[model samples]
Target chain A: MIQFTNISKSFDEVKAVRNVSLSIDEGQLFGFIGPDGAGKTTLFRMLNSLLIADEGSIELFGLDPHKDYKKVRQIIGYMPGKFSLYYDLSIEENLNFFATVFGTTIEENYHLIEDIYKQIEPFKKRHAGKLSGGMKQKLALCCALIHKPKLLLLDEPTTGVDAVSRREFWDMLKSLKSKGITIVVSTPYMDEAGMCDSVALMQNGQIHAVESPKAIVDNFQKELLAVKCNDMYKALLTLRNYENCYNVYPFGEYLHYIDKRDSKPIEDINDCLLKHDLQEIEINPVKPDIEDCFIELTRKLSV
Target chain B: MENEQVIIVRDLVKKFGDFTANAGLNFHVDKGEIFGFLGANGAGKTTAMRILCGLSSPTSGLVEVAGYNVKTHAEEVKKRIGYMSQKFSLFEDLTIWENMRFFSTVYGMNKTAFKERGEMLLRKLELFEKRNRLVSTLSLGWKQKLAFTVAILHEPSIVFLDEPTGGVDPITRRQFWEMIYEAADNGITVFVTTHYMDEAEYCNRVTIMVDGRIDALDTPAKLKEKYQVNSMNDVFLALAR
Candidate 1:
């Protein structure tokens, strides 16, 4: 449905988005996961024709985003990360305005956003600024979808809302995809990465990994262990100072340790703990999460 | 008493006219726990956070943060709490050091103490080299890290980070979490609200808020298992469904 060939964008000397080429299929929820300033927004803006790429080709449904922006805009729904709706307008008014922009009426596209709209309908008369962050988000989603574009580009939709709201918003997106709307979303949330059909893990204006979340996790080439001890702080100190420790860092309640290239497996970890006289020892292989993979990838890049 | 929580709010309520943003909310955070406050849009997380940080007044309900009542002793709460807002909460035009100093002064830290703390915090975030640089000049991730540092510069007993990692890189997000651990190790209670479920996994415990109400609150593992989902996002979806 979408194709980009050697898309490279720059703002003066800084290359906000490096030459990137990838193809996205139709009826798919594609996740672009990266930190701020990694050019996620820049790339999205380019796709929507809000900004022109310095060097590259963007084909949306086989039409150029730059040349066919008007036709492209009609087929795409964009929910910006920043609250872009008129803050003074009521929720209904924003929806109506956006619907009118695409030469449609709220009555016409009301069914598309009805699920999300009903949640905020009680506050329909309230000013957007008066709504909570989560409410504003839903309203934005409703307004964006009012036109019912074939492609939806949401920039960090769950960035500021609460956990439940974040969950609810994704639910709405999944429902949208069920209606066969091809969705593209950019988020910094690693947990959200696994929900998508495919994801492109990006860093420093470059893609670190791009594949299904499961495939990426399944491709982990290193053995991982979760180690808990009497003094986790001391254990971390001991582990980081250990001779064969590859990556030793605390993860929530336990410290996650990966052995060096040539280090032994479970026995070696147990032996190290026994030698340190650490109590309540628990050394077991564990699956690495997207965050773990992300941290590992970033560390590799830094090195 | 030693196991007692640092923040305890019962029936926490906030209203804007007839609208009740937070109604009858009850939650607490352990002395040094990284508590995740999850909620959808309009779920009252921000309102509750505002009251906790002394930024806004709760219309009703008993609210306690770091042992301070939100209503009667907001100043005391402010003195002991640090806050990072959802947006560009820092001064866009000011230098990083200036912004930190200004926040220090607002928090009533004296010159000597502010100087020592400011330098230390800046160094911890590796922003010392960019201390004199304008806030606008720094990348979004760098600015957020600096903001998180400034929030805790007073060494407050509790810190509230409201979507502090939004729009930043994954590496920076990991680094931000690292700083949170360092703070927790130093005995500072972290109260945060983020849309990232993976981040929710980092919290000692997480509470899910939907439509101004808490739907689920527990360890990420329990929540994931209960929902029969592999990720926090799915856990949230399962509960919401």
Candidate 2:
């Protein structure tokens, strides 16, 4: 449903996207996983035809975005990274405004956003700005889906939202996807990447890898160890200084450490920490997740 | 132990007309501790934080920071505390050095001290060469770390961070928390609010606010064990429910 061929975009002297090419199948939920300056926003803007690419080409359902952006927008729903709803308008008023803009009525496309709108209907009279972060996101999603668009482009919809709200938002997207709507979401959260059918691991305006979360993680070249001790801060410092330690990062309560030699470096790690008077040291072998894969990929890119 | 309490609150209450934003909130933060404040949206986290930071007046109760009463000495409390919100307070158009100079001057730092500290900070962050570059040109990760450096530049006794790692990548967020850890190691207490459950796990202790009151306050491991959960997210869901 979406295709890009050697697409390149630059802001002044910096290339926001460079020779990137990718495709999204119809009805598939695609995630662009990357950091803030990773060009996901720039690429999304180009797809929406809000910004024109400096080079290469883009096709939306076999139609050139640059040549047919007017009609293309009618079938695509976009929620920008920053909330763009009318803060002064009531929730119901915002929905009505969005429906009217698309030359439709809320009743006609009520099923499209029924599940989402039901969550925010109680506060229909409240101003959009007065709603909570989760409510605002639901209201925004309702507005975006008010016209029953075929595709949805959500940019970091769960950013800054609580974990519960984030889960609910993704569940809403899953329901929408079941209805045969293609969704392209950009998020910095690596955990959310697993929820997508396929994701493009992007960094520095380049697509490092494009695969299912499982496949990407399964391809992790190194074995990982979840390292912890009585004193975590000192453990991290000691692990970083270990001769065979390739990378040491804080992962929740424990540190994720990678070794240069793959042959069960647990004894070596234990000895290194044991020498530092660290006690109760625990090192467990683990599988890499999407965040670890992304970090490793970005590290490779940097080097 | 009593002297270690950098922040002490007793029955703090804040009401917005009829709604009780903070319902008799009470907590104590020890010196050089990383305290995590976790809650659902509109769960009174921001309201309680505002009261602690002296940005909002509580309806009733005692609130103290750095051994000074928040009500009677808001200015004094503000001077000894640094705050960095999710939306950073840096001048985008200004160069890195100019932004540092502006904030230091606002905090009444002397010229010689500001110059020495500013250069040292930038070099440590590897941004010394880009000191003349506009802040707007820096990446989000760079800007976040820089903003954090600026927040603690004045050597405040406590730093209040409201979701300081919002919208940042996982790698960068980890690095940002490293800076927080370094500050706490240097004897600067950190009182931070975060939505990430994993981040809450990094704190020395965490308070979970629900419906304008603290539902639970304890270390992350204890909370998880008490709730029979493996992660802070589950513990939060249990409390919020």
Candidate 3:
């Protein structure tokens, strides 16, 4: 369990996290989703006690992350976004060092990280820097779990990893969650938003929305449409500049647009396209996904 | 020509001294497809990519990237292919426009080519106004977009991007993929890697690597079907477990 009350963090003149307050439940996969400089990492460091917040309080497992940094370190496992593991040490050696630092051994919590360990086991003798992106992730996860902390804090754990390893790593977290461990994973990937039990969509160091991924999507107030035309670029410009459009953004092959007139007649779309000289047009009402929710939320908040 | 493979690797093995980073890897990326190369951390994906980019050598393997043999025609391959490294390594001292210009010159683009492509990319990325700003002053998401634009300055046959959207917001990432798709539509093969499964869904084909070998390779739909999971993330967890 974790709690932050009116927490504000700043680096010199810039405020990273501003007046933030939230709670993360036990045995949950909590995600902090935002763009870079949104203050997710700053919040992570404060919660982990690497950096002290300028104002407010952070409590982890009933202990303050700042004042009780030492004890918090004992009960919480943290994997920083940037590769913070010992690069010079071999995979086994890095794991050993982290375990020793946490006053434990790999064998003690081997079961917690076993799924990840197996992949990096063959390279137990390979230097940490020498390992590939996926292996490094496995090693970091294994090391984090060595102490069997009740809370795990991972900052963008899947950033540069390949898709498969990214998937496998999340699965490892899921299994760990089943064992009743409170996991906190931060990522810029909005799609990963669905995987968490709850998420806080952070922007500009403030909490925008916090809820289950599905709940966020359900909360989307606009009716969405996926549209494609002969020239998507030209079409996007046409759509964005279209009259009374709430939101018009490109999503792969189609432009996911929301109109102020959600229930507008289909004939109106053709009439609008005809005016713009846009041909090969198709529009279908579509369900809003996490990204759509993210964009919609940010747009409304900014307005 | 429509279905021609852009990057073809067979029995690809890459060993750095005693460590075999990539082991007997085999895969093909078709022309104009956005292929997602995936793996867990330490999963040999980067190793295989570096070899195909001609940045590193394969101990023993048969490989072709844009029709050039990686070993014998590395320079030619380098010319025809673009790469965006995982770590954004833009020149901080240079202005955004200057950086693009420098890279264009490095790729041997003529003045006409530079002006034509430069304006096109800047407009496409919405970086036109800030082109005069130093690279260091740009936001992370903007820098990422610019870095990607620079990679394809020469309009390489294939663009290999390694986690090009790290630490950016989801909205920017969505926009970034759209650019990649547009590039693919123009007959430029895209070989990209990412830790996000949703991004993987955008790829024509995806390869998931575990422990220096590919554990699965297929479209996101096929992969989901193969692993009996509704999502690619779940599929990875199943294989990893």
Candidate 4:
């Protein structure tokens, strides 16, 4: 449904996007996973015709965004990373305004956003600026869906949102995807990559890898180990200094450790930590996750 | 060093007109401890944090930070404590060295101390080569690390970080935590607020807020066991939902 061929964009001297080529099938939920300045926003803008790419081309629903800007805008809904809505207007008014701008009415697209809009219906009279972060996010989603566009583009929808609200927002996206709408979203959070049908790991304006979340994790070449001890900071330092240590970083309650070799080398890791006077050492082999894969990919790129 | 309470909040309540942002909060953060403040978007985390930082006054109850009552000793509290948010704490237009000099001067550091610590920090962060570069030219990760170093440049007893890792890459996020760990080891109490549940596990103690009250307060391990969940995210979802 969407395709980009050798797309590249530069702002002044910095290359915001570097020859990125990607495609999203119809009715698929695709995610661009990267941190700020990773070109997710630039690529989105290029797709929506807000910014023209310095090289290559973009096609949405087989229509070139540069040439057919008006038609492309009509068929695609774009929600920016920063909340972009009529803050001075009430929640209901913002929705109505967006609908009218898209040549539709609230009554016409009510079913498309009913599940999400109903939650904020009681406060429809309240100004958008007065709403909290979660409420504003919901209202933004409602506004984005009011026109029933064929494709939805959300840039970093869960960036500053809390964990609970982030999960709810993902669920809302999933429901929208279930309705056969092609959705493309971006986020800095690696864990959210798992929720997408496929995710493009982006960094420094380049796409390093794109695959299903499970496939990405399975493709991790390292034999990962989770190590826990009484003093995690000391243990991390000790493990990083180990002879066979490839990479060791803190992950939640434990430190994710990788050895230079393909083997687990659990006893050697435990011995290294124990020799450093670390106590309560526990080492277990653990499967790599999307965050681990992303880190590994970035490391490979830098190397 | 072992059990000294750096921050003490008892029945802390903050109200905005008729809205109660914080309702009867009672907690204490020990010296050299990493305390995690977590909650939903409107769970009053910011209000409670502001009161502790002496940025905002509490409507009722006592709130002490850095061995001073926030209400009467707001200036004293501000002098002894540092604050940094994800939005940034450094001047974008100034070069890295200039930003450091400005903040150290604002914190009233001696010339000798600022010069000594400033060079040490720049070298440690590997930003010494780019010291003359403008802060606006640095990447988000670099900016956050620089902001963090400058926040603790004054050597405050406690530092308040409001979501310091927001929108940062995975590698830099861990690196930032390493800096926090180093600060705590140096006897600087760290009070951080974050939305990443995995980060909550790194805290020595975490307090989860709900609506306008303290819903759960305990160590990550204890909270996990209490909620019968394996991860802090599940515990947070259980309480906040």
Candidate 5:
């Protein structure tokens, strides 16, 4: 369990975090979803007691993070966004080092990371720096879990990883969650937000919304339209210039279109594209996803 | 002219001692096409891209980029192609204008041409006022957009982008794709790699690599139908599994 009351932090002129107040229940898989410079890292550092907040208070399991820094660190496993491990050391050595630092041995918590560590056990003798990106990630997770911490703080674990590896990493997290560990993760990918039990969408050092992924998507008020045509690029330009067009962006194979009218102007949109000499235009109303909701939230803030 | 092949790779094999990074890759990228290069980690996407960009040599087979054999005319290939990656592209310590000037000079652009084109581009991206600000001062979205603009500043025939929008926001990511679209429309071929499945759908053609081999190659629609999936994410999951 964790709680933050009116948390505000600033570095010189830029406010890294702006009065963010959030709480995570025990055994909940909470996610901090935002892009780089969105204060996810800052919030994590503050919670880990590595960075002091400019104002407000933070409590981890009813214990103040700053006042009880040592105790807080013992119960929390913090994985920074940047890979922070002994690259020169072998995988086994790195895992042992982390376990020793936490006043524990690998045998004491072998069950905690056995599912993940076993995959890289064959290459335990290899240097951490020599391992590939995915291998390094697995090793790092094993290190983070070596102490059997009750809370796991993963900062953008899948930021630079590929799709397949990202999926694999999420599966591992789900398994860890099943073990009754409170997992707090951050990522820039909106698609990953769905995997979390609840997510806080942060942007410009502020939390826009904190709710279940399904609730966020259901809150999308606009009637979104997916438009596909022979020439998507030309169609995007044409749709952007439409009089009632509020926002038009390329979403995979089709352009997601939204208008400023209450009634769905599908015919008018089709006519506009047709007048622009676009062909094979197919416009259909589609459900909004988490990314759409996040974009709408950010746009609302700017407006 | 539109259908002209700008990049041709045939039986391209790259070996690292006992390991074969690229077993045998055979593909051609047409002019003005957005080609997506995708693969799992250690799947040889980087190996093939390095060979195509002339950053590394192939063990065997013929690889040509920008109408020149990369094995022999690596310099010519480098001259006609621009490369940018998510990790490293621009100088963070340097100001926006200085980074642009440095890259332009490396690409052998004249002072007058660099100044005119750089100013125009900065103005278009609405960063002319902040040209003197260091790249580190700007946000990640701004840095990526600037890096992309500078990548195409030299007017390369083909641009190589490796996970260029890795951590960019949703809105800025779409804006970056719009830039790619504009560049391709100007006859500049785009060779990009990304983890976002929705992004793979935007490519004119995509080649998915698996274990140093080309697993599948086709347009998004065709690949979806072939794999009996609704999205590129499913297609990738099916193959990479």
Candidate 6:
């Protein structure tokens, strides 16, 4: 289990994280959702003890990260946002090094990373840098797990990785979680937020909302509508100009708009667009997803 | 000539030493099209893009970009194309205005024309107030938008974007695609590489690469239909996996 109370961190003039608090239950899969400058990385570093918080305290497994970092480092598996694995070293060599550094051998904790390691085992001799993005990611996870750590902290593990590979990686994480490893992952992709048992949406270094994906979606107050027309760009602009429109943005091929009114107002919306002579217009009431909730939540924070 | 082909690659192969980075690739990008180049890392997307951009030579096969043969007219091809890599191709130390001026001149834009267009662009993006701020000071989304605008500053016939939306938030990514659509509307071809499958849906057409070879190429809808899948992500998995 991990807990942060009123934690804050700053670098020069930028307050990366400000007055944030959250508690993660043991063996639970948690996600930190935010954009690039939203301070997800800073919060992860504080938990990893790589960077100390400017204020407040952090407790991991009833131990202070700053005071007991030595034990913290041993039990926590960290895959930084950037690939910190040695590019020149072979995959097998990197695994050996990590295992040995943790005072263990690959054979001792082989079962911990068996599923992931097998994917990259065929290319065990390939240099880490030469491997594909997916292979390197698996290898990194394997290295982080070689010592059989109790917790895993992966920062943006799916960024820059193709969608298929990203799905595969998440599947691997799910399996890892089934083994009772507490996983803390951070990502900017809102779709991935649903994969977590619970998520803490952070923005501008503050935690806007923390809840299950379903809870967040259920909490979305606005009535949602999905509209598709001949010209998507023009439709987006026109929809944004509607009087009752609270938010309108592109979602795949359709422009998902949230109305300020409680009702869907399909007829009024149609009449508004009819005046513009848009073709192939289709408007339907739709359920909001985690992304819609996230956008709505963050918009409120900004305003 | 309604949808003229601006990029053509036939049996294109690129090898380094004994490694074949690109293997017998064939694809064509239409003018004014939003073309998606997608693949797993190490699938040879970068190698093929470099060859098309005239930054590297192909080992064999015919390739043309912007009406010029990449091999024989590398210089000519370079002039008519713009490229922005994932890292955001901008000088971090330079102010926004300075970076804009520098890239326009590099593209051989007239000094007077750049002055007028540069101001207009900054104002349109609402970055005119921060024109003197260092590029590094801007947020990730702002930097990406600026890099994109600079890439097309000269109105190149084709602009190459190598994973332009990596690590950006959803709202910013959507806004960035609006910019891409705007460019395509102006008759400038956009050849972009991205990992987000949702982005592929916005493209006019997409090509998926696997192990140094193109596995699939068509409009997002067509590919999804051909693969009997519901999304581009599923289509890519069907081909690449």
Best by lDDT: 5
Candidate 2, residue B92: how far the Cα is off, in Å: 1.7
Listed for each candidate, the true contacts retained, as a fraction, are 0.57, 0.59, 0.55, 0.74, 0.79, 0.59
Off-target runs (Cα >4 Å) in candidate 5 are none
TM-scores of all candidate predictions against the true structure: 0.83, 0.95, 0.79, 0.97, 0.97, 0.93
Interface RMSD of 3: 3.3
Residue A269 CA error for candidate 5 (Å)?
1.1
Q: Give a tens-digit lDDT track for model 4, residues B76-111.
A: 999998889887598999999999999999999999
Q: What is the lDDT of residue A247 in candidate 5?
A: 97
State the displacement of the C-alpha of residue B34, model 5, in Å, after optimal TM-score superposition. 0.7
- What are the per-residue Cα lDDT tens digits for candidate 1 across B195-224? 656668678799988767778888877888
What is the TM-score of chain A, computed separately for every candidate?
0.95, 0.97, 0.96, 0.98, 0.98, 0.97
Task: List lDDT for all candidates, in order.
Answer: 0.83, 0.90, 0.83, 0.91, 0.92, 0.89
Q: After superposition, how far is residue A285 of candidate 5 from its true place, in Å?
A: 1.3
Q: DockQ scores for all the models shown? A: 0.43, 0.62, 0.37, 0.73, 0.76, 0.58
Ranking by DockQ: 5, 4, 2, 6, 1, 3
Per-residue lDDT of A115-155 in model 6, one digit per residue for the tens?
Answer: 88888999999999999888889999998898888989999
Better of 2 and 3 by lDDT: 2
Docking class of 4: medium
Tens-place lDDT digits, model 2, residues B78-189? 9999988778678999999999999999888999999999999889988999899999988888888999999999999999998887667778888998888888878899
Question: Candidate 5, residues A1-303: lDDT per residue as tens digits?
Answer: 799889999999999999999999999899999988899999999999999999999999988889999999999998887778899999999999999999999999999899899999999999999998888899999999999999999999887777888899999999999999999999988889989999999998999999999999999999999999988888988888788999999887789999999997999999999999989989999999888998899999999
For the second chain, the TM-scores of the candidates in order are 0.93, 0.97, 0.95, 0.97, 0.98, 0.96
lDDT of 2 at A254: 80
Docking class of 2: medium
Highest DockQ among the candidates is held by which one?
A: 5
Candidate 6: C-alpha RMSD after superposition:
2.3
State which docking tier applies to candidate 5.
medium
